[model samples]
Every structure is written in structure tokens, then in C-alpha cells.
Target chain A: MLRIEDLRVEIGGKAVLQNVNLHIPAGETHILFGPNGSGKTSLMLTIMGYSNYKVTRGRITFKGEDITYLPIHERARLGIGVSFQRPPTINGLSLRKMVEICSSDREANVDHLAEQVNLSSFLERDVNANLSGGEIKRSELLQLSAQQPDLVLLDEPESGVDLENIALLGESINALLNRGVKRSGSDVHKGMMQKRSKSALVITHTGHILDYITADRGQVLNNGVMQCSQNAREILKWIREYGYQECMTCTN
Target chain B: MYKLDSNGEVNPKDFSTEAESHDYIEDLAQIDGSDTAEFENVGVETDDSNRSATFILKDLSVVHCKSKQEGIEVLKITEAMDKYDWLKDYMWKDISPEKDIYTQQASESPGEGFFIRAEKGVVSKRPVQTCLHISKEGFAQNVHNIVIVEEGAELHVIAGCSTARHAERGLHIGVSEFYVKKGATLKYTMVHDWGEKIFVRPRTVTHVDEGGVYISNYISMKPVGSLQMNPITYLDGKDSIARFNSVLVAAGGTDMDTGSVVVLGAENARAEIISRAITTGGNIIARGSIIGNVPGVRGHLECKGLILNDGLLHAIPELEAHAPNVEMSHEAAVGKIDQREIEYLMARGLDEDEAISTIVRGFLNVDIEGLPPSLVRKLDRVIADTQDDMM
Candidate 1:
């Protein structure tokens, strides 16, 4: 559903992302692996179309449309959603109000999703403010759960939360996928909604996210450069046994 | 119309005399460093011969003083007179002795007068903001203001007054009169800040016609020795509404006596007054009174004070309802800043200054929605400057 080819970006007179290419086909989930200062967050921010990130040479296509120059809110309007690693604390704006503002379909079951992500109690609080780091993560997942987007971006969604909450995050993502299918109960048994695809590109520092959801593909990024793609499970096993340092010999 | 006589009081020049008026104009023209007038084309003149009111009456002796410690008494009177001259003709001629600056300042000459007149059905969207600064010591300022929002007209006025240095005695006597016509709306905001040794007495009154709305927001941030302000609005119109919201902060040897009185005289008239004061190093006495005279009139008064120092703060609220259908209520409180609230903000990584400024700004801020952009910008600056000293 989303494709990036040779994404070269410059920020503050420094190269943050250079010659990076990745593709997530329909119904596929991909994991982006990188260490600190490894351009992982930069790639996410670039994909989100934040200003000040100069895309010198790149082509980002989503749903067969070139959205490289699209504004952030416009891209969001076009069924693109993101969960920031460290979300901002919006003081006066309530969480429920922000969710309603960002979502397209008002008929979506918000209360059930809030209950599923453990954010039912924090529905009245200002967005992400006064919330514990773990609570903030769950709130992010809850907001994401309500958004039936064609493509989703998650940045370190499992960094600060507990294991159980992390599993809940996985379940919420699954629920989001199920909702995006738009199939009735009787038709679901017949796989009538199989034609619909839910795509996502997630960034993870640790392989713990692999424990929650099945990622179809994996790519390692270093200093704004991406290596060859491989199977997610094999890459997970490789990283677990050795580490990202194992790729030092293959610098090319 | 009543007139104040000169008995042991500094006398204003006989402006009723044409020769004296001519000479005064010539002197002001020379002092303003122009042959004619500075803002001659900006406003309307009383007559075709006289210039539009822009010249602020500033005395020569006070302006030439170089010493900073002469005390603010002299400069205060001069500054107040300057504003009075700018507003006089637009206001009424008769003022009570208690509201007269000539009686208060026997030695210093009074300031200018400000008068505003809006014809019927005039809707003014631009807010008028005036700033008065007392730079020298021994300053005495007497300013008089009169505003008339005619039928169906609207206006907003913002005033900021301050002294240059701390610990100087400045004297200020200001009188303001507002007349709101039927279906008109008027909003007024006044901020008072003066150096030490300053004594201020301000008297204000307003009369609302039928179907008129009046909103007054007063803030006292800096008061030197003693500051007394009495603001009143009389609602004589049916279906009229009046509200007074005041925020006062008295610190460091300051003494503030601020009060607001609202009287509902017509049927279905409504009035509300909210007064807040925060004292750190001095004493503050804030009082609010609401009187419902006609049947079916409604009024409420609320006064709150926060005492930061062991300094004394008293809040007295009173309500009077004569008619059976009228409703009146009053509430008053005296306390300190809530520590838990400050601690909560501090826990959010904001410094002490940031948290305090935020709290103060929020406390003083009201819904200024629908106000002009220019006025909002000026109010933001006023908040910033006042927050700087406390935080």
C-alpha cells in the first residue's frame, strides 16, 4: 500500500536519511530496526510529512498516489495515521475531542476500543498530559484502534509500556485490521473481506514487538541507509542470536 | 449637574473664558513642538475653530526634573492631568468633591480630561487602549474620562497605568463616567501599577440604558502606599446586563482598597460582579455590592482574595433585593495560593516562575473572544509585563 524509493533527506545541514528504500504491499506489516541516532525516527517523521525535513531525493507513493508533497493533515485525511513515540501534551484539548477531530468515520465504536486499550478512565483528561508513560502508550494504541486507516505508522509503541499492555497493543492493532476489513459477521466466515488490505510500517528498537504481532518483512537501517530486506522471523532470530553489529563485516 | 468649587483646592484654568482657552491652546501647541496640533486630524473638534483633543496637559516643572528619588507625587498629578485634558470635553462638567482631583492636590495643577461620544446605532469594533507612565518623582496625575456608548453602539477600552521606579510616592486621582444607551455594549479593562509612595484614588460610574450591556474588567497589579478605587454601574434599562470582573495583586508595602457596586433599577435587569485580589507584602480590602431595585431583577456578587504574605486581606460582598421576583446572592473569601496547584504545575517540568506566571495569567484571563486583534495583542503584553515582576 505504501512504497518509498531512494529516500534521501537532509535536516539542519546534515544528512539524516539517505538512499533508503522500503515497500510494504497490501495486507503486509513491516518492521524497521535501528539503534539510537540511526535515522529510524527520522524516517518516521519524514513519512509523516513534518516540515523542516528536506527530502532532497525521494518518491513516496501511497495507494497509487504520489503523496510526497502532501501536507500532514491532508495525508491524515487520506486514511494515513501515526502514533508518535513521544506524543505531545495538548493541554486544553481533551483526548476524546482530539480523537473525534482526527477520525473520518464518526460511527466508529470509540467506547469499546477505549475499553480494549485501557484508556476508558482517561477519556476526559487532556491528550497525553498527566498520563504515565505506560498509560500514554495505551492511549496511543486506543487512538490508533479507533482510526480505520489504510496505512499506519507506529514509532516504538512498546518502548515504555508493560508486557501485558504491550500484548494489548498487539490485540488493538489486530482489532484495527479487523475493523478496516469492513465485513459483516456472516460474510466474514466466507472470507468475503479478504480483498481489503491493512498495511503498516513500524519502528522497533528491540525485537520485543516481534513477540506480540507477526511482521511479514524486516529491514535494517543504519545512518540513513537501508540494507537488503528479509523475512521478519529469520531477521528476528538473527538479531536475537547475534546483534545489529553482526552486519559490520558486510558494510557494503 | 453639580460643580466643585475651589476652596483650598488647586484651581483649573478658567477654560470657560475664550481668551484663556486660546492662550492654553497656544501654550500646548508650543509644548507639543508644533505650530498647530499633533493629532488634529484624528478626532472631532468641539467647534470648527478649536483643534481635536490630543494634547495631554503636562506641566513644565515636573517634566524637567532629573532626580529619580524626588518621589512620584509630582509626576503622578501631571500624568493624570495629561489624560484628563485628552478626555475632558467628552465628559460631564460637574464632579463631586470626593471625585475631584483639584480638591485632592492643592499644590499641583490637574491633568487633562477624556470624553467619548458615540451617536445612536454606532458600532465601534476597535478597542481604545491608553498607557500612562510616571517617570519622575513627586508626580501627581489627575485624569478625568467620560464615555458615552449611544444606542446600539459598542466599544472596548483598555487602560494601563504604571510608575517608572519603585518606592516613589505618586498621587493619582482619576474619574471615569460611562453612559450606555439602549442595545449598546461596552467593555472596559483597566490595569493599575505604580511605584512605592504612590497614593491613588479612582472614582468611576456608569449608567446603562434599556437593553444595554456593560462589562468592566479591572486589574490592580502595583500599588505603592494606598490605592482606593470605586467602580459602579447602574442598570436602569429593562433587559439590561452589567458585569464587573476585577483582578488585584498587591505586593510589598502596598495598600489597596478596591470595590465594585452594581445597581439594577429596571425590570429584568441583571448584574454580576467577580472580584479577585492577591496580596503578598501589603494589605488589601476588596468589597462588592449588588442591589436589585426593580422587580424581576437579578444580581450576584463574588469577591475572592489570596494572601501570599501574613499581610491582611478582607473581602466583603453584599447583596440587596427589594422586589419579590428579584434574585440576589453574594460570596466572599480570603485565602492564600493553593500549594497543591503550584506543585502540580512544577511536577510538569515548569520552573517556579513559569508556573506562577501561568497561574496568574490564567486567573486574570477571561474569555476575550470577539475582541479586536489589536486589543488582544496589547492585553497579552500587559500580562507579560505584570507577570515578570511577580514570577
Candidate 2:
């Protein structure tokens, strides 16, 4: 239930996403594959409504509603949530308190969510203060579990994530998708549901996310222009063999 | 008292009257008291023209009162040659001692009169300290002092008043004035610790020149009836500054009405006034005002009071700014000391009284100034004693 057509973005006078077109349907988890500076992170940042990236021309429709210019908070309220690459350190504010504030249900059980993401130890700590990289990742997951947003955006979740909790991350994501039945009557069951999933645009530069999650469609974005949107396995194989130079030449 | 000649040599000032001046000299010579050398020109007489101009401070030890009076026992000292010249004319001939007229009950007779003045371009780095101690009952002490720091000069003075346990119905009224010249700086500290049944009224006026700076620090403890103090400051010259830092405590049926005012009349002038009070079994009212009229001038006033043990604290702060470019802000609040902090400290192993003492010390330490390290250590001991008493 997501659509992108002719997406063109300019950042710092440099085009990062050009003429990009892709579609993610209900119940599918898609993995994006590209080399460094392939505009994968830029796409995620733009989708999350970060102001640093400018959209020159594009249309992004989620559930038949255009949300290209929506503010970050509004998008969040509309069930679009993002786990930042680097969380900010906000002093005098507790992590558990923020999770409670962000939860869709005011009476959401905080201890249960904290246990799900292995963030029970940081309940009293200031938000992101003195948190290890892995701890911060789990804390973000805890928030994600609490919110249970309709569309979840994750950036470099594998980075700095300890091996002990990576499986927990995958399980938490799966549980988040399986929760809170919308009016659509379609619920995720953690199988080959990627084909009919509501949609997830997972951004990855090294294609490492493919090992943990499945993908239905893949796109190769070089510099600012999309070379092609092809099968996820095919793009992974091509990049593993001939490298991104092939994508650059294809864009030229 | 040492005397300074025209050539600036050490000598002795003659204190005897004109009729007794020769007899005093003869007695000194016959007694072989070499240390009591007299000077003929000492104790210079003041002219009537100069008598009405300078501020006059009567020495506390030189007065006699036959009966109890409601008004100040005015002591006129126009015949003293060692008197400071700037204070010769501004002396008030009469001052009221009525309950409303006096800020507090006057106590303890003073010993000898004293005078101090600063010439232009002179600076004194060390603070001149004086201690007034009253140990007798129904004793009235009156003191008037004048200070004039000429242009480009700097001076610091610290005065303290304390009394014995038996001191009762004591009255003290003192007035002090400062004349600050261009580019001059003056810092004064007044500390009061009086016994029960003591009344004190103190008024001070400070005038600052262009580019001048004036600072006053006041500390009060155990005022019997009431200790009323009003410090008025005027900053007329550009780039001038005036600051008042005070801490007042009124306990055991005492009432204190103390405040300060600063007027910034020129561009680039600055004024800051801060006062903290702790009231326990007493009444305290603190009010401060800062008026800034010129552009680019800055003024700030903050008054805070703590009420504990059935005491009352009232604070009012007013700030006026006429120039758009000027920064002026005033805030006042009266409340009890936070109980949460005390509980936290207690949870950390400190007893309740120890915790309270720590909080009071921190609150009173709003001005950890340039006091000597030794003096600071002594003050720490004093704080420890206070905490022990509270506990």
C-alpha cells in the first residue's frame, strides 16, 4: 500500500534520488541494495521528513494518501515511525517517559515493551545519555514496540548492533507488524507475508539486511538517479559480481 | 591614634580640650609616657560654612544620656581636628528616635568617634573592619559616618555589630554616605549580630561617577525589635555600576524591613541587586527596585525569602526600563525551603538537621566573594556551629 513515482531529490546541490519509481504493497518487507552514497539513507531520511533533503519532483503515496510534505510529528501521528541512525541525547527526560508519551495507547504497558526490546535497564536513564550503541538500538526498538506504527522506517539498524540482540530486533519488527489490526482485516503472520504486506522500504547499502529479512522488490540508485528497479536477489548478485560500476554506467 | 604631619610623619593627636590641652601635655611629660606625644594642630576645629556640608559620624564612645529618650541622642563633633573633611557638612543635626522614626531599637553607648575619607586618586586594597559590641542594658549608641572615594580611587570597608546575651533595650542609629568620583571603585560590607531587645536603624546613600563602581554586602542575624535598612544608589555617569548583595535572618520576635534601590541615569550603566532572607518565628519584608532610564543600560533585581517555623516572609521587586535597548528584569518569591532536597540528603546518610544546615548554607552562599581564605575557613566553622545548634 505504498507508491513512489519519478522521485527526484537534491541535497547540497547534488542529486541523490532521480526519477526513482518503486511500489511496495501490503504485507511485504523489501530490502534496498546499493553501494555507498547510493541515496538509500537519503531516501529513508526524506521519507521520515528530515528537512536536510529536498524533494525537487516526486510523489509518495501511502495508503492512497500523499504525505510528501507532511511534518515529522504529523507523519508519526499518522502511524509513520522512524528509528534514527543516531539518536539525540536529551537530558532531564527519561527514556521510559518518552516511550509512554509516544505510545499510541496511553495505557500501554511500559514494562512489557521494555522487556521485549531488552531495554529494562535504561528505564531511569536520561534519553540516550550514557547509552551504549547496542543499548540505544534496543531503546529505539522499545519505542517502536510501544508505538506499533503502521509504517516503520529503520536506518542502518545493523550498525553498532551487538550480535546477541540482532535476532531480538528481527523478532520485535515481526511482532510490531503482527500487532493492532487495522480496518484492512489483513494481519502479518511472519511467513512469506512479504508479498502481501502493507509495505516496508528497508534501506541498506551493503545488502546485509537481506540475510535477516526478505524482499519483494529491489532498486539500484547510483549517485542521484535510479538505474533500475529489479528483483532483489538479482541486484544483490549483480552488485556482488560486477560491482556498482555497472549501475553507474547503466545510469549514464 | 597616629597623626600625619604636613611632611607625612607619625605623631599623636591631641584629644584634650583647649583649656586642658596644656595640662594634658604636662601630665604626659611628667608621666614619662613617650608614646603619648601631642600635636598642636591636631583636633582641628570645623567652620560653620563647612559644618553644614559634610556627613558627620559621632564616635560611639563620646556620648552621655541622663534619661531614656525616644529620639536619637545627637552628638555634635565639630571641634575634632582629625575629622575627615568630606563629612564635615552633610551631618544631620537632629534624628528622630520614635518607633517609626528609627529602623530598630538603639542599644549600647559607643566609645570614641571615628572618621575616614579618601582623596582623589587614592586606593586602599585592604578592607577596614570595625566591630561594635554592646553588653549593657538600656544603653544608647549613635554613630554617623561619611565616606568619599575621590576620582580613580578604590576602597573597601567591613563593619560588624554584635552584643552580649544580657543586652536589652539598646538603640543604634547610624547614617553613612559615599561620594564616588569618575572611574573610582568602592566596596563595603556591613554585618550585624545583635542581642535581644536591640533596635537598629541604618541608612546609606551611595553616589557613583562616570565609569565608577560601587558594591555593598550586608549580613544580619538576630535583630531584636527591627533592623530597617534602605540603601539608595545613583549611577549618573556613563558605564557606571552599582551592586547590592545581602542576606537577612530574623528570628525570635524580630521584624526586619530591608531593601535597596538603584537608579541608572546614563547610557551603558548597569545595576544588580540580590537579597535572600530566612525568617523563623519572626517577620521579614524585603523590597527592591531598579530603574533604568537610558538606552543600553542594564538592571536586575531578585529577591527571595524562606519562611520556616511559623515565620512570615514578604518580598516585592519592581523594575522599570524607559529605553528599549535596556535590559531590566525583576523577580521575587517567598516560600519554605524545599523538603525534597532535605529528604534526599537525609536518604544519603545525613541527619535531618545536618541536611537542613547544608541547604541553608548553600542558599546563604549566594555571594562567595573575595574573602580571605583564612576568613572563609573561619566562616565554615561558624556554619558548622550553626548546624550543630539546629540539630
Candidate 3:
């Protein structure tokens, strides 16, 4: 449901992502694996239409619509949601209020959603105020769940979360992608073969999140270039065994 | 009788003109009562012909009327002294004895004020509303208000002060004293919406007895020429509590110097002072202080300021702990609204202006808990109105 054609992004007069091409068809989840400073987050932010990430060349199409020039809010309204690696703390804005703002219903059942992410007590607290890394991720996931976007972009879901909270984050991410039912072991093959409508583009450095959600495809990004696209598990295994430099040599 | 030196200290006056003072009172009386309807804009229920709460409306220096409410006795200062001998013992009992410039002016040019008392064991569900309104131009209105919540009683006082739109430059000096007796609770709320040429100086002090509670909520969301006040409170008895909360919005070149001081003097006494100031184009000096003097005392002060445009804000918070077992702390912050927060909200479906208004409203909301539901609703309405005005 997403396509990028020779996309180049520049931040603060420096090119961050160069001539990148990516495509995620409908009903599929793609994983983008890259090392540090490899333009993984820059790609996600540029696709999300952050104003600071100037698109110097090419275009991005989501569901056959040109969203490269769309504003952040417009993209959000068009069923695009993202969980940032580091979200800003909003003082005086309550977590529950933020969820309410994201929800289509003003009086949505926010308590239940927060409870799912083990954040019931934090509903009244200010958004991300004095929260730990895991807690911030949970809060972001809670908001994403409320939004129920068709295309979910997760930036480093497993980066700072503890082992104990990582399972919860995995379940929440799966639920957002409509893979929760399949993970529950009730006719998994049937659920996976039903032509899932939700799509996702998850960025990871360690590929730890692949343990929970089944990604349809994987692509390695190196030095602002997309090196290869292959089977998700095969690509992760190759990177783990041979490192990213070896992948660059193989792609060349 | 008092006189003012170049230093603005109170000095004894040898002689004064009675005719001049009488003429000031006469000018006050000349205010047509029909203008009272203008108060409706400031959240006063003017259409309520049966106005239940005790009201004190001062037009310049004249006492328009002092109405009494049930379960609470409201009397003019002179009438209170003449009616009850005990009233003499309570007047000026809690405030500072040494008169400052404002207190001296209040004494010298006396205006009609209220002596509101809630009887022992009585619970006044309806608030005692007082309005110190300035209707005339180039006049000084000096008022002295005394409030006493007797033992085991509860009272809520709502005071609204404002000036007429066309009113010229004026000065208002109010000296208020409050006494919360043993096991009593007093909730006081004051809303100020003054004209551009009005200057306000309010000197207030409160004393809380054993097991008593005192809560003061002050809101000034409209423009005023200048204001300076530092209200003080003493938690003198065991288990007594005092809380001071203020929300102010300064615009139109208004200069405000406001602060609160709370002293925790008895064991287990608790005190908190919270001030939130929002400056659009004016200047604000927000100050707060809390002192813990006895064992087991806990005190905290929080001061936050939000500057919108070319406005200036200065915050000064002080905390003192004299006893080893006492805990005192303070936090002060001044900043502009975060653009990221606005963008976050915008991405959540709100437009730019809507996002900004939401943040501003949340910043101004102090969320004083345990207030009466009706009063909370009224405060919310006033806050919403203020937000609309800001937009």
C-alpha cells in the first residue's frame, strides 16, 4: 500500500537519505534493518512528512495517492500513524486526554485501552512526564491503538524497552497490525491467509521485534542506500551472521 | 488619622477636611444603581432578583447595599461593631498591626465593607458573594472585609471585583482578614476583571486554627492597569492546612506583582502555594513562599509562568524549614508554550488554533480538588471565557 521512487531527503542542508526506493504491498508488514546513522529513522520521518526533513527528489505514494507533499496532520487523517523513537513530553496534557484526542469518539473507552498497555494509573498523569523508556513506548502504543491507523510506522519499538515490557509492546504492535488474532493461536494460518488489510513499516536496528510479529519482507538500508530486499527471516539471519558491511559487498 | 511622608509611611495627621471626605462619599452615592447590571458580564447572576448571597457593592466610596444570606451573618463594619460586642475582638485581629501605605489609605478613606461570619457548627452551602465595583472616575475606594468561620463550621465566599468600562483612573485598597476556627473549613474565591485605568492593592491575611482548613483561589484573567499584593496565612494549630492557588492573565500593559506566604507553625500542619501566570503583553512578577517551623510540618510552593508574546514574567519561590523533621520544597519555572506540543496535538486532529487553545486552557487550569461542583463549573466557565478572550 506504500511506494517510494528514488526518494532523497535532506535535513539541515545535509543529505540524509539518497535515492531510496521502497514498496510495501497491501496486507504485508515490512521490516527495515539498518545500522546506526544508516538513515532508517530519516526515511520514516521523511515518509511521515516532517517539515524539517526536506524531500529533495522523487515522490511517496500511499494507497495510490501522492502524499509526499501532504502535511503531518493531513497524513494522519489519511490513516497514517507513527510511534516515534523519542516523543516530546507535553506538560499539563493528560495521557487520557491525548488518547481522547486521537480517538474518533470523544468518550472512547480509554481506560480499557490504557489497561491493555498497563498504563491505567498513568491516565491522569501528564503525557510522558517523568516516564521511563518502557512507559513512554507504552504511552505511544496506547495512542496508536486509539488512532487505529491503516498504515502504522513504528520507529524502534524494542530499542529502550526492558525485557519484561517488551512482550507487552509486541502484543500491542501486533494488535495494531491486526496480527493479534493470528498470534493468539486460533487458526493462525487462516487469519494470515485472509488478506490482512492493515500494513506496517517497522524500523529496527537489532531485529528483536521480528520475534513477535511476522514481517512479510525485509530490506537492509546502508549509508542512505537500500542494499537488498529478501525474505524477512532470511535477511535477518544473513545480517546476524555476516554483518551489514558484508551485505553492502554482496549488493555491490 | 494618618499622614503620608515622602517615603509613603503612615504618619499622624493634625487636621483633615471632613467636607472633602463627605464629598467623596457623595460622589460615590451618585452612581446610578442601574449600572449594577453590567456585572453580569463577569459571571455575576444579576438576573437573580432574589440574590441569595451576601453582597457588598462599592461604587467609589459609597456602600450601595449589604445583603445577608441565610446561615451566614453579613454586616457592615460599623453595624457589626454596634450589634455584637464580640465583633470588636475579631476585627483587625489576624492582619498585620503596622499599617502600610494601602492599609493606611483604607483606614483614612474608609469605604463600606462586610463583616461576614458563619456561625458555629453551621454549614453554609450558598456562598457569600461580595462585589467591590468601581463605577466612577478618578476616585479611590478603600474597603475592609473581615470573615470568620466559627468552630466546626464551613463557609464558601465568592468575591468579584471589577470596574466600569468608561471609568477613568481609579485606586482600590482592600484590607481583608480571615479566621478559620477549630475544625472549620473556609473556601474563598476571588475573581478580578478590572478596567485599563484601575490600580488595585489588596492586603489579606488568614489564621487557621486546630484541624481547620483554608483554601484560597484567586483568578484575574482580564486586563488591569496595575496590581500588587502579597497575602499571608499562618497554620498555627495541629493538623491545620492552608492552600493558596492563583491563575492570572496579564495583557494590555498591565503590571502585576502578586505573591502568597504560608507559615506552618504547628506539628503536622500542611501548606501549599501554587501560582500560574500567563502574560500576553504585560509584565508579571510572581512570588511564593512557604515556611515550615514545627516538627512534622510539610510545605511546598509551585510557581509557573507562560509568556505568549513580548510579555515578561519573573518567578521567585522561597522555601524554609526550621525544624529538622519538617519538609519544605519549592519549584519555579518560566517558559513559552512548546511548539512541538502544538504540533503533536495538531497531528491528533486538532487545528493549529484549537491545539494552542487547548494547551493554554490546560496550563491555566490549576485543578483545585475538593471544590464544590457548582463552583467548579463556574470556574470552568470563567476559564473558558478567558480562553476565548485570549484567542
Candidate 4:
């Protein structure tokens, strides 16, 4: 559902992602593996149409529409959501208020959504203000859930979360992508079958999130270049056996 | 006559004739408005306004409102003193003993104001709503208010002050003294809405006795020429609590200087002062001070300012502790709104302006706990109205 063609992005006149091409078909979840400063965030931001990214050569198409020149809010209106690795703390905006702003349904069950991530107590608290690592992740997930975006971009959701919360975060991500096990009867599932499939591009550093999310494809990004595209588990095994340095010699 | 210096010290002004003070009062009386319609927006009942709460208009015109509740009396200061000689002792007792600029201005030509008294063991369920409005140009409304909450009594007061639209230069000086007796609780909320040429000076003082609770919420979001005020509260008895919350928005050449001082004078007394100031193309100075003088006393002061566009904001917070067992702390911050916060809100489907308005509203939202639901709703409406003006 999303396509990036010859994307060359720069930040502060320095190229961060060069000649990168990525494509994720409908209903497909792609896993991006990269080390620190490996342009993963740069690619995500470029896809999200941040002006500071300076897309010198890029044509991003989402749902067959050119969104490369779209503003951040316009892209959000077009069903795009992201969870930052280290989101900035908003001093006075409450978590529940942010959810109300993000929700497509004016009367969305924010309490239920917050309950899913165990953030009911934080609903009244400031967004990300003095929140711990896991709590920030849960808060971001809560906002993403309210957004109900078709294309979700998660930046290292498993980075700071503990083991117990990570499971909850995984379940939230699954529910957000509409890939969770259907608890409603088969009749309700049949009615939802006609809906459009959800897509996501998850960025991970440790590959720990793969334990919960079933990624269809995996790609290795290193030094502002995409080297290999292969099976999600195979790439993880390759990286484990021989670090990212070996990806330079591998064929796609 | 006397004038208060910038350092809060009283200085004698040049002698003025009695005729000059009479002329001031005459000029004030020229601005007349019994409409009470303008106050409806602030959630104050105007139809039979006196039946609900005490009503005060411009100058010394209409102040004959009687409290419907037993053990609660709401009347003009002069009337209250004339009716009950005991109230004379509380009048002008907590404010500066020597006349300052505000006090002198108020005394020279006193305007219509309320004297609210909650008798001992009485709990006033309804808030005393006071509205002070100016409708004419070049007029000054000098008011003096006294509130006495007797022992074990509870009272809530909401004061709305505003001026007519497109009005010429005007001045408002209000001197308020509050006495919260032992085990009593008093919640006071003041909302100010002034025109472009209005100058406001409000001097307030409160004395909280043993186990009394005093909560103050001050908000001024409309445009004004200039404003300067420093309200002080003394926790004079053991276990007394005093909390002050202020939210102000200065826009379009308005100059506002607001501050609060909380003194913890007795053992185990606690005080907290929190202020939030937002300036858009204007100048604002937010100051807060908390003093812990007795053992086992705790005090905290927080002042935060948000500057938008070319506006200027200054935050000055001070903390003092005298006793070795006292704990005092203060934090002051002055900066522009965070771009990331705006962008974060924008990404949530809100346009830039909408995002900005939401953030501004959030910044102004000071959660005042323990307020009645009705008062909370009224306060929310006032805040929402002010935020609409901010946008």
C-alpha cells in the first residue's frame, strides 16, 4: 500500500538516506533492521513528509496517491500514524485529550483503549510528562490505537519496554493492525472481511518485537543504504550468525 | 495621599484637595450600567441576580443584595458595618495598615463592593458571584471587599470583572481582605476581562486561622492596557493550608504583572503557589514567593510562562525558609511554546491553529481539586471562553 522510489533524503545538508527504494504491498507488515544512526528514523520521517528531511529525490505513493508533498497533518488525515522511540514530553496536554484529537470517532471508547494498555491512570496525566520508558511506549500505543491508521510506523516499540509490558504492547500493536484473533462470532468476522487490509512498517534494533508481530518481510538498512531483502526470520538468523557487516556481501 | 513604590513600600504622594477626590467619584458615577446582561456570559445569574448571590455594579450604585441562606450575609461594606458593629473589626484589618496607592484610591472614592460573611458552623453551598463592570471612558472604579468566613464555616466566591467594548481608558483598583477562621474553608475564583485601554490593580490579602483552608484561582485572559497586582496570604495558624493558582494571557500590547506570596507562619502549615502566564504580542511578568517561617512548615512555588510570537514573558520565583525544620522550594521557567508539542498535536489530525489553541488551553488549565462540580463547570466555561479569545 506504500511505495518509496529512489528516495534520497538529507538532514542539515547531509545525506542520511541515499537512493533508497522500499515497497510494502497491501496488508503486509515490513520489518526494518538497522543499527544506531542507520537512517531508519530518517526513512520513516521522510515517508511521513517532514519538511526538515529535505527529500532531494523522492516520490512517495500511499494508496496510489502521491503524498510526498503532503503536510504532516494532511498525512495524518490520510491514515498515517507513528510511534516515536523517544517522544518529547508535552507539559500540559493530557493523554486522554490527545486521544480525543486523534480518534476518528468523536466518541471513541478511549477508556477501553487505555484499559487495553493499562494506562487508565495516566489518562488524566500530561502526555509523556515524567513518564517512564514503558509508560511512554504505552501512551504512544494508546494514541496510535485512537488514530486507527491504515499505515502504522513504529520506531523501536520494544527498545525500552520491559518483558511484561512488551507483551501488552505487542497485543496493542496487533489489535491496531487488525491482525488480532477475532473474539466476535464468525458472523461479525464475515462482515469485517470486506474492509481494507491494514499495513505497517516497523523499525526494530534488537529484533525482539518479532517475537510478537508476524512480519511478512525483512530488510537490512546500513550506512544510508538498503542492502538485502529476504525472509523476516532468515534475515534475523543471518544477522545473528554474522553481524550487519556481512550484509554487504549478500545478494537480495 | 500615598503611593506604593515598585518595591511595595508606601510613599506619600503630593497633597490632594478633597474636591479632587470628589471629582474622581463624580467621574466614576458617570459610567453607569444596571444591565447585568454582560455578566451572563461568566455564568452569573442576572435574572433576580440578588436572589442568587450578592451583585455589585459600577461605583456605589446597586449593592443591596441579601443572601437567601440563613447564617450567610451578603451586603455592601457600608451596609454590613451599619447593620452589624462586629464586622467593623474585620474591615481593613488584614490589608496594609498605612494607605498605599491602591488603598488611597479605594478610600478616596470607594465604589460598590461586597462584604460577605459566613457565620460560624455555616456552609454556603452556593458561590457568591460578584461582577464589577465599567461602561464609560476615563472612569475609575475603586472597590474594597471584605470576606469573613467564621470558624467551621465554608464559602466559595466567584468574582467576574470586565469593561465595556471599545471603551476608552479606565482604571480599576480593588482592595480585598479575607479572614478564614479556624477550621473554615474558602475558595475564591476571579475572572478579569478588560478592554484595550483598561488598567487593573488588585491588592488582596488573606489570613487563615488554625486548620483553615484557603484556595484562590485568578484568571485574566482579555486585552488590557496594563495590570499589576501582588496578592498575599498568611497561614497564621497550625495546620492551615493555603493554595493559589493563577492563569493569565496577555495579548496585543497588554502589559501584565501578577504575583502571589504565601507565608507559612505556624507549625505544620502548608502553602503552594502555582502560576501560568501566556503572552502573545504583549508583555507579562509572573512572580511567586513562598516563605516557610515555622518548624515543620512546607511551602512550594511554581511559575511558568509561555511566550508566543514577539511577546515577552518573565518568571520570577522565590523561596525562603527560616526554621531549621521548614522545607521550601521554588521553580520558575520562561520560554516559548515547544514546536514539538505543536507538531505532536498537529499530527493528531488538528490543523496548526487548532493544535496551537489546544496547547494554549492545556497550558492554562490549572486543575483546582476539591471544587464543587457546578463551580468547576463554570470555571471550565470561563477558561474555554478565554481560550477562544486567545486564538
Residues B1-391 of candidate 2 have per-residue lDDT tens digits of 2222354222111121111111122121232222111110111112212111111221243222111111111123333323436344544322223323332232122223334455577656445444444444555555555566778877665555655454555656665556677998877766676655566667667788899999888777544575667778889899999988887777657778789988899989999899888776677889898888888999989898777666778897888887778899887878866654453233223446755766676566656365544335544554565444334
Ranking by TM-score: 4, 3, 1, 2
Candidate 2 CAPRI classification by DockQ? incorrect
* Candidate 3 residue lDDT tens string, B275-332: 8998878889999988888789998899999887668899989888888888888898
Evaluate candidate 3 and give its CAPRI docking class based on DockQ: acceptable
Q: On a 0 to 1 TM-score scale, where does candidate 2 land against the true structure?
A: 0.48
Candidate 3 lDDT at B311 equals 83
On residues A55-89, what C-alpha lDDT tens digit does candidate 2 reach at each position? 88988877788978875555666666666666655
Off by over 4 Å in 3: A104-107, A160-165, A182-196, A242-252, B1-43, B46-52, B60-71, B94-98, B323-325, B370-391
In order, candidate lDDTs are 0.64, 0.62, 0.79, 0.78
Q: Which one is best on lDDT?
A: 3
Query: What DockQ does each candidate score versus the true complex, computed on alpha carbons?
Result: 0.03, 0.01, 0.48, 0.65
Residue A211 displacement (Å), model 4: 1.3
Q: lDDT (0-100) at residue B135 of candidate 4?
A: 60
CA-based DockQ, model 4: 0.65
Candidate 4 lDDT over residue span B1-391, tens digit each: 2333467333212322111221222222233243344554343455433333555565335533546688888887777778988877777786763556657767766666788889999998677777776665666777778889999999888787877664566777788899999999999978787877667778888999999999998877767777888888999999999988988888777888889888899989998899888777788888888888878999888888887766888888988888788888888888877777777776777877777777777877787554444445655665565455555
Superior by TM-score: candidate 2 or candidate 4? 4
Candidate 1: stretches off by over 4 Å: A1-252, B1-95, B98-111, B131-136, B164-167, B343-356, B368-391
**What TM-score, to 2 decimals, does candidate 1 have?**
0.50
